[model samples]
Target: MPLYAPSPALRGRQLAADVGLLAWLVLWVVVARTVHGAVLALAGPGRAVEDLGASVAGSMSSAAQAAADVPVVGDELAAPFEALGSAGGSVGGAGQAAQDAVGTLATVLAVVLVVLPVGWLLLRWLPWRLGWVRDAGVARRLATADPALLAARALATAPLTRLAALPPGTAEAWRAGDPTATRALAAVELARLGLPADTLGRDERRLGLR
Candidate 1:
């Protein structure tokens, strides 16, 4: 299958468009990564809170141990410190939960940021590129297999202005199997596809028609 137009100008444009699309995808990926990092930065405070809670829990646990060594009030004194330690542990859990939530948000937002615009562009661009490849392949085969078919396609699909620009009686002559008119019409169709008009001439020579 033909991947690009035979014409130098059209081929160059296709190449440029492909390169641009690659660049666009790379740019968006970089942007998504940057945004993800920025969002993840918000977790710094959560980490600080977790550390503070852990520090408090450890200190309270140590104090409770020390308090248990007291005489009569030892058990009662240790109870309050144990309660404080439990509260600190709850704070640490809350901090961890906040960090998890932030991490999830960062991932989701980054995915959305990359998917929407990139997917939309692909939806619009892929069909046209694929269509060109299909049409060009068909045109290439038909150019050799049946120049008359290409002539007929030109008569049916070429703009009226272009049709009129052809020599007078060109369409009527093509229908009458006039070689000149058939070649002319075929050239028109080939030009529209950015194929060389000489493709028809080569086929004619191979068939001993020239």
Candidate 2:
């Protein structure tokens, strides 16, 4: 049920790691925003082109309207202006499409930049953190309910060097139901997990060793 190690040193390290992860995420988010802005800047030329096209279209449309009022050859003169205005409108449409494409590209790039690194880190980190929480919770419960189970787990999982640091024949003694050996082995496992000795309970006599 604990989110951190009972040991101050281990708990401090865990807290530091959590803080580092948060900082990393924030840093990448800022970077992504900056990149998005930079990429969006590429749309400036498209905006200029769209404005120029619109101006040309508007001018030609007005010219066409005026020329249609000419005395004799009005229709022939207005036809060319109308055609030029349609061409300008098409150019404006193309510019708008280019701006839309640039916007889409910028968004995609920014998302990929953040998602790849941050998501990769989260994928690696979240499972380990959650696994520790689950395992530590189980260990805490077993420490109270059946510390022998913890001792057995230590025998199976603890490094041989660590087991050797205990009294000679500690494993054999544990197999023989020696309460001291059981408590010692259990303590080894608890300490490995950064849990305190008292997690086995204040009264050693009440432990499941008997």
Candidate 3:
């Protein structure tokens, strides 16, 4: 048997739900991509960081070179001055590498923490919001149930707030543990589902309650 037989209205609702879900996914991904790009732009090879490193290194190299010119010690200081230039180059290279690492980490974090989680949560929850699958499943389960079983199931599963649409005292009576009130509430709801009262004893017999 097919898992569900959804009405045309239900199918239409499902289609709209699908379109909305797709739109949301695309919009979310685009926004995430834009934010990711912005983060990379700010962190990657930016002039501020690169220039800071280069400027510091150049200043150090120039100072060291100028200091190496004392007549008596000039030859003796040449090696130290050259070492300073090498250290300056190392510093510049290290700073650039650090910036690159930071940018790469930001990209990874954005995808892991933001993009993946949003996609997962939306995918998991959005389908349930489609009434066709959900209502069809509920309807199928209730189709073979007896009146009392239907009432019992409704009491267990239906939201209490939904009872407000029934006769005035329905919610109050059900909340007060009145079996009659519960059955009446179920009757109204099941009627809307096109089921007649006690149409089958399958559910009650299975539950061993009748």
Q: What does the lDDT read for residue 28 in candidate 2?
A: 87
Q: Give the TM-score of candidate 3.
A: 0.48
lDDT-best of 1 and 3: 1
Worst lDDT run of 10 residues, candidate 2, spans: 201-210
CA lDDT of 103 in candidate 3? 80
Candidates 1 and 2 compared: the better one by lDDT is 1
The residue pairs found clashing in candidate 1 are none
| Model 3 stretches with alpha carbons more than 4 Å out | 1-5, 44-78, 101-105, 112-127, 130-135, 145-148, 151-210
Q: What lDDT tens digits, residue by residue, belong to model 1 across residues 1-210?
A: 778898998888888878888887888899999999999999999988888899889999999999999999999999999999989998898899999999999999989988988898888778878988888778778877788899999999998888899999998998888878988898899888888988774578664336
Q: Rank the candidates by TM-score, best first.
A: 2, 1, 3
Choose the strongest candidate by TM-score.
Answer: 2
Candidate 3 per-residue C-alpha lDDT over 1-210 given as tens digits, one digit per residue, 9 for 90 to 100: 232223455445556766776776777667767777777766555445566667766776776677677688875666676676677667677767777876887678667655676677677656665443455446546644444545666656666666556578766776675656756766655544444545433564554434
Against the reference, the lDDT scores of all candidates come to 0.87, 0.87, 0.61
Per-model tally of clashing residue pairs:
0, 0, 0
User: Estimated TM-score per prediction?
Assistant: 0.87, 0.91, 0.48
Candidate 2, 41-95: lDDT as tens digits:
9999898889888988999999999999998999989999999999989888888
